[model samples]
Target: MNLDTPIEYLKGVGQQKAELLKKELGVYTFNDLLQHFPFRYVDRTRFYKIREVSADMPSVQVIGRVLSKEIIGEKQSRRLVAQLKDDTGVLELVWFQGIRWADKLVQPGAVFIVFGKPTEFNGRFSISHPELELYNPSAVKQGNLTLQPVYNSTEKLKQSFLDTKSLQRLQASALEIVGRSIQETIPDYLRSKHRLLNKADAIQQIHFPQNPNSLEAARHRLKFEELFFIQLKLLRNKLLRTGKFRGLLFGQVGEKFNAFYSDKLPFDLTNAQKKVLKEIRQDTQKGIQMNRLLQGDVGSGKTVVALMSMLLAIDNGFQTCMMAPTEILAKQHYASLEKMMGQGFINMALLCGSTPKKERRIIHQALQDGSLNILVGTHALIEDEVQFKNLGLAVIDEQHRFGVEQRAKLWRKNSVPPHVLVMTATPIPRTLAMTLYGDLDISVINELPAGRKPIKTIHLFESQRLRMFGFMRQEIAKGRQVYIVYPLIKESEKLDLLYLEAGIEAISREFPLPQYRISIVHGKLKAADKDFEMQRFVKGETQIMVATTVIEVGVNVPNASVMIIENAERFGLSQLHQLRGRVGRGAEQSYCVLMSGNKLSREARIRLQTMVKTNDGFEISETDLQLRGPGNIEGTQQSGVLDLKLADLAHDQHILQEARDAVIRIFEDDPELNTDKNVLLKEYFLRKTPAISWNKIS
Candidate 1:
């Protein structure tokens, strides 16, 4: 049988078992079963005495005789209790489930093997629902395995009598059926040079390891292979894009750009901004398509860089567009840019879902006639009715919120394709950026703007509500606005909204409406209503804006100086950082109060402490990566993050770096992979191309 043989064709896996495997573990073929490596290994070479079994022991195995069995309790409390003796001592074995079935096999003086965790009750040790096995001296002597592999199993699989033991049997059977016949995926030369185990042996040893050393070798081989292919794929795409596409040339910084920079620029560009602008200029001048990711902290001047880049396009007589995920952010960008554009003879328009039909028509006409130099909007910009005259550069804000297809639509707007620049305020950990955005050249705005005071972060318990409220009153008295952010947990959205409404009522009582002028906003609010509330807050018509996480993205209000986050512990570290970013935009010293309950988990405490300690986004991102794995990071869900089965991005960075370097070396040897030594690499990719790859677009 081949590796692709249906799993049901195996010796013992019937259709029933095969379906269970597929549904439970996504294992449908022999190869899949083989690749489903064990999470941990247990030594089975020795057995412990019953007398030596302590309550503190993780697990223990003992060969004993079932001396007595009795059905204890009744109904839901029913249990099967038995006394087992192993020459040294008598031990209590109890089964809270399957009493009828358990009482039969375990009878008087029947020799059996028992294994489970030992727990003490009333100073007596007992095993609850221990795994029972028939003792066989001949089978014990015949078995050559020194260690046993433990695999993850679902409750449904266990219910079908297909537990970890059954999974282990299937793995062993898979190896036996396909043993040496398991074809290698990695090239032999690379494996040999790297001292990696062959694919076949690695698969076998990973399932049933002979020793710890061999197991480690097998893990290193598999992890390297997984990460190696990914890096190769991303790097290859990057090289292909850079070499293949000829971008629109914005050769020189012209009039509009010069006018805005020298005359109307608010503050001198930070060195970080100048470096990134230089990179863009260099990329644009080379006539190669630019697909670059610009990462900055929340308050970093990325918008300014984007504006300057767009101005370069305008100077070269080309149109530009910037797409934000939401209308609020779109309008915010439009307003900010309008103020920045000032007296410059630059024509810009904003288009969104809420744009009036007349304005949309005017926008369409301006865009089609080449009068509009820049268009900033939401998904409405990509609508069929709205088209750019000569699209030269497209800047996608919070790029992860848009799908590959959406971004592709923008790319297709121009025949030669504009230089695509993706801007994200979410600081990506270096390891994540390596794997997720490796195809795009990354430039980070590591430095915050000068003269901006760091947000004063404080952690407080719920009992300090009076203090928090009084502090809010003090801030409000100083003519500064306040933002009270409440987390809208998805599982209980309605409950959270109700809690938010209750909070609004309480705040009104405390501050007294008419005089307080608090604006309430949440996900449930209608778009028009939410916009009205947001506008009210932004225009200073409201003293406090109470909202959910909806405002976490791009609601820019320089006057809002204090941010109060309720249930701060419920928010992720990156999320807390983002919410805190809302306040510190102004020159005034701002404060972020993280209000949480009394009880806090160790991880939650660390997250709060990290927030209170530093204002560096990269540092906070690293801590967030440690506290909550790479999965929950905002944009990485679809960026090859889930495909990782074994490699820990937080800890296996060394292996990832090694794999990346190896890919580079391969490219250096034969860029096209046409050489005899690299043909296997191409073959490997041909057999395992992903359904959708991020390398295709920004």
Candidate 2:
């Protein structure tokens, strides 16, 4: 059978087993089965004695003879228990689910080899459902048990008799069909230059390695292949877009930009900000659409850069639109920009779900008449009824929150799509950015604005609430506000309200309402009510704001000097970093108090320590990447950019770099993969094209 043969047609995997393979592992064809590489390999060369086995050990192998076998318990709970003895001690082997099947393979006097995890219960050691194989002296003499590959299997698959061992057997049978038949996908010259293993040998060694060195080589080759293809795909799209789409040229920075930069500038732009602005100017100057991703730490003046870019568009007689994910953030941006612009000739408007009908009519008239130079709003900006007259640039804040289709809708607003500048406060790790946003040009605002004091982070236990409250009082006495953020309890809103009530009560008892005006906000509150509470805090009507993570994204309170994160351990490092960012926006010295429980996990401790140590968002991001893999990062898994099987973004940075460089060389030499050397590459890419272009979404 060929590689394209259905898996059910294979030797060991019949229709029933094939369904299990497809359902559990997503393996459909013979080739798909072959590519399902083992997660780990075990050495069967050495056998451990029963006395040497421990609870902390991974799966271990031991040569033993079954001393006694018994069927214990009644129906439904019935199990087959066998007492196995090596040289030193006796070990109990129990099978809970497959007692009938296991009772056949193992017997009282049979000499067998057992492999499984060991656990101690009630002062006795037992191995539940150990893999037992008949022991043959000649098999050890022939070195047949040197290495064993273990495939991941689901419990359902195991119930259907397709366990890990069954999967391995099926894989071996599929490999036999694929033996020496696999053709090299990469060009021979590139393989030679990179010292990569051939596709056939790599596949074989990956599944059943003859030696550890071969296994490592196979891993390197496979990882390189996976990353190389991803880079190639992203780079190819970038090239195609640049070649095909001509951007509306903002020829020069004119009146509006010059006026904003020279006359109405709020603060001097940091060098980091200046550099990013320069890069953006260069992109807009070129006659190509700019799909640039601007990454910066919270409070790194990203909104300022965005404003300057919008002004650039306005200077060239075109309108700009900024879309935020939420109405609160949209209003915040509109307010901040309005305050910054300060009654200029340039007109700006805010369009959100809550915008008054009169204001919406005015915005629509101004937009249609080309009088509105800039519009900032939420998803309402992309509504069919709201259209732009001369939309030249679109700036998306927290770009990950929008889907590809939503962004595409914005692109269609203009015949030639406007220059798209997507900004994020969450600092993406360099490697992750390369894979996730490789198609988009990236600019990082790495420095905080000058004169901004680094927020001092402190970790305190629940017992230290009194001290935290005292510190809050001191900060409030300085005429500054404090934000107390609580984690959301999704299990029950009643329980959540109880937690919020308890916190509010404690704060009221400590800093009473008449003495301290405290506002409460959460997701449970209605939109208008939430806004009312938030406005009170922002307007400085309240001395303290007790809220949930709803305030994490776009709340800007310059007067707020302290952020007290209750149960900080429940928050991710990135979330903690974002909450910490809320307070340090002002020029005054700020503090972030991370209150957690007495007991902390190793990861939790690292997160707290990292927060307390530095204010670098990139550093915090890297630590976060390590602590909670790429999948758990905000919106990344949903983006499908990190849908990797084997090559880990956390650990394979070097491989990724190498693969990216290789892609660059390939494109530089042959942009269209038209050469004979790259025909295989083109075919492979065509065969594996994803159903959705995930990168375009972000």
Candidate 3:
């Protein structure tokens, strides 16, 4: 038997059991099971009598005889109840599930060893769903007593008689078959330098540790290995792209860029923006493909920087394309460009899924004929039919929404890939960015443009609704519009749509017709209808815009000075920050009111508190990372790259840094990893390289 052997061949796991294992735990082969590391372990060295078991104990192992067993109650409330007795006292065994199976195992006058935590009820102690095994004095051996591994399993697996104990038995059998055959993955020199345990020993110790010290050693070695490979992949991708890829050279900053900077400029260039432009210019001037990630907070002038970068491409006799995630965002960008450049100074067109067929044909013709200098669109931009005549640079807005492949399609447009500039208003923590976007060079536009006031953020309980309404009235009285947003549009079942619909009604009553006009929007609305409502708010024809979080990343309504998010506790921190960003776009002193019920979970409270404490998206993101972990933060870049089983970004940032440093050190000595000392590392990557996905482009 080997790592590649099907799991059904294992002693206890037959065809039926293997199917359950695969369905429940995603384990189908011996190697998959081996890598299914234990979430925790339990000490099973001591035994206790019934008298020794107490309510305060975490768990106690007791050898006792079952006095009686029976199934009580009917249907949903049915349970298997049994009585067990030792020399001193009796313990109750209860099973809320698996009643028939448990009843058969628990027979009267049968002696068994039971293990579970004891709970007190009415002056008596009982153990629920305790681990039970038939006691055999002769079968028990000294070597068998060790730390028992507790695998993360499902209720279905348990019902199929594959509980933690069953999994442990299967693991033991697996180790016996593939024991010493487990090849060393990391190099011996690196292991020795890091004081890590050997691969075989680490894998063995992790599953069935002899002692706590050994378990700790195993953990360190395995965690290091996991993170090391990730860093190696990221660094190597960067090394390869920078070394092999050629970029289109933009030798001069010409008429369009100069005209925009001097003639059409709206605001003075912030220092941060100037610094970032310098970086982009340097990358494009040199004949190296630029894969850069531009990060900034909302209203921090990322769009201005993006526009200027595109202009640089245009100035150098090359075309540019800017892609946004939604039609609303794409139109907003096109409008900004139009307002800045005026009509016909530079030919530009917008293409979306909803664009009229005739306009699409004209835009397509312009792109191929070299007349379209800049094309702005949603995912439609990546479609095969649309082609650029001389695409030099590609700017992606809210870039995390696009997959690596979708972005790669833009690179595939030209003979040599364009200089890629990825922009995101959602803040990514340093550690997460290093792991996810490590291949790309990063620039931060950290400060807002001049004359923009810091948005005032406030947290309010449901009881303070009237006060929030009063503040909104005051803001609207100043000729500024108000945005009253509900939690999420996706969960129309969560009654949020109901809340938004009812909210518009209530607002109609509060500040009745003629005096006030409210525009309603959500995902369910038709595209034309949504656009109509959005335009109403933008044009200041409506004093209030009531909608779901569909307004999270869209139109810039500078007149919308107040943002009131109802049921704010339901939203994630990053999202809450993004929603708050909707109102603060204008020069007026904007306010974000987060409204929630009085009762809140600890996590919910922390999220609300973080929003109120600061407008810094990065700090809020760090706290959000700590609270919701890396996977769910603002629907963090959905890529297979972050499918980590063990190492956590929140708690293991130090280890990640150390691992990254180690990779950098390796590349310094042998960038190609072709040296004799690094031969093993080279071979490992070669063996593991199965058609690469993310290694090609950022």
- TM-score of every candidate relative to the true structure: 0.91, 0.91, 0.89
Better of 1 and 2 by TM-score: 1
Question: Candidate 3: which stretches are off by over 4 Å?
Answer: 43-114, 120-125, 129-146, 488-498, 635-637, 693-698
Best by lDDT: 2
| Candidate 1: residue 627 Cα off by (Å) | 2.8
Model 3 lDDT, residue 387, Cα:
91
lDDT of 2 by residue, 1-698 (tens): 88989999998778998887898889999998888888988776678888998898877788889999999989888889999998799999999998879988888889988888899988778999987778887762622455678888889888988887887888788888776788788889889988999999999988889888888899999989988988988888888778778898999989888988898888999999999999999999889999999999989999999999999998888899999999889999998899888976578888999899998999999999999989999999899988888899999999988997898889988888899999999999999999988999999999889889999999999888789988998999999999998886233545322266678878889998588899999999999899899999999999999988999987999999999998898889999999999998888999999999888889999999999999999999999998888899887977876777779888899999999999999999998888999888988887788553423422
TM-score quality measure for candidate 2: 0.91
RMSD for each of the candidates: 3.3, 3.4, 4.1
Give the alpha carbon lDDT tens digit for every residue of 1-698 in model 3.
89989999999889999999899889999989989999987777778888877788877788889999888999999999899998999999999988878977889999988888899999888989998888887884522356789999899999989988888988888998997899888887788788888989988999999888898889888888888888889899988888889888999988889989998989998999999999999999879899999999999998888889999999888899999999999998999888988998889999999999999999999999999999999999999999999999999999888887899899888988999999999999999999888888999988999999998989998888899888988888899888888855444764433376667777888988899998999999999999998898888899998898899987798878888899999889988999999877768899999899888999999999989999999999899999978888764648666878778889889888888898999999988887888888877776776566433533
In order, the Cα lDDT scores of the candidates are 0.87, 0.88, 0.87
Clashing residue pairs, backbone N/CA/C < 3 A, model 1? none
lDDT of 2: 0.88
